[model samples]
Target: MPAVRTTFRSQNHRGRSCRDFPALTVTFNVLQLMTIAFVWLLALVPLTLMALGATMLRAVRPAAAPPGAG
Candidate 1:
């Protein structure tokens, strides 16, 4: 076994962990999450429009009854 050395070290701030987020980090995270959500909804727009069109088409006509069954 040889001496093992660690390359990554944490930042120091009054014994606080480096993972503590600054204002910019939090803002970026929120923006990134919102962007992803926005893209997801944008991707669904086509499908939603198709469904609306189908509903409109359905509203345009009713099913015809069988002969002698009216």
Candidate 2:
């Protein structure tokens, strides 16, 4: 009788632990996704500004050849 009770207790504990695993995994996945999105946005800002600056410079300044031109 004691052995049967112990087995039932262990089974209940195992079932609860298993149920909690997916919730922990989903939380971790959400945090990782948020971190990746933040890093991507941080990187994109500088690149976008650089592209805009290049476009503006091209519009404002025309290229000049050397003094001894053909």
Q: lDDT scores for all predictions?
A: 0.78, 0.79
> How many clashes in candidate 1?
0
How do all models score by TM-score?
A: 0.58, 0.53
Best by lDDT: 2
Looking at model 2, report the run of 10 residues with the lowest lDDT sum. 3-12
Tens digit per residue, CA lDDT, model 1, 1-70:
9997654655544456536768767898999999999999999999999999999878755555456664
Per-residue accuracy of model 2 over 1-70 as CA lDDT, tens digit each: 4654445456547547545689888898999999999999999999999999999898756555455662
